[model samples]
Target: MKRPIRVLVAKVGLDGHDRGAKVIATSLRDAGMEVIYTGLRQTPEMVVNTALQEDVDAIGISILSGAHMTVFPKVMELMKQKELTDVLVTGGGIIPEADIKKLQEIGVGELFPPGTAMKDIVSYIEEWVAENRNF
Candidate 1:
């Protein structure tokens, strides 16, 4: 049997606006993925740890606190530090386009800003997991 994709949707740093995160989480869930939401004010470590323990296929971090640079890299670093490279890391927020490019360059996946269709994120994850998942 094919497993439903499991995803951890997290809010990092002081970003308290979770309406977007909740929306994405619901969309991903409705798309037949298991979702765990790590609520507001989560550290990168918390997110990586949760993803590790949950054994998620991907992590969707919703960041609006202008800390995408620090938080995304930290999460990516932790994912590497803990050897969670098989887990995909992506996010949505107010990140600049240039920074988004840089993040992708460093191995963080896509960064979706507001107004991105939920289906796009879901499809992106599906394809990414299929291509990148080691097992």
Candidate 2:
């Protein structure tokens, strides 16, 4: 049988707040997905490296430091460098809609903003992984 879907939920940069990340991790776990949460103050490289090490199907970054532009692009670049093409690079926080569009254009997956439903996040990850990851 195939192993459970694995997701890496992370808090990047100086975002000391992590309640959302923890909640998502727990919810994903409860939803039957294996979740690895890289706690607060993570760099893009660190987050990507941990995702690689864990062999996760998806990477969920929780950033609220107004660094979405820098964080998402840097992580995307590193993911490409590591050839983690199949891994979903997604995130959520206080990001503007225009910025979300830009990030999506550059290959970042669906980004959730504050107040997005947990069920939506879970379904999005599950659908993306089922279609993309070779699990």
- The superposed Cα distance between candidate 1 and the true structure at residue 29, in angstroms, equals 0.6
Off by over 4 Å in 1: none
Local error of candidate 1 at 112, Å?
0.6
TM-score of 1: 0.97
Question: In every candidate, how many clashes are there?
Answer: 0, 0
Candidate 2, 67: how far from true, in Å? Answer: 0.3
Residue-by-residue lDDT tens digits, candidate 2, 58-118: 9999988899999999999999999989999898999999999999999999999889999
Collision pairs in model 2 = none
Each prediction's Cα lDDT score?
0.92, 0.92
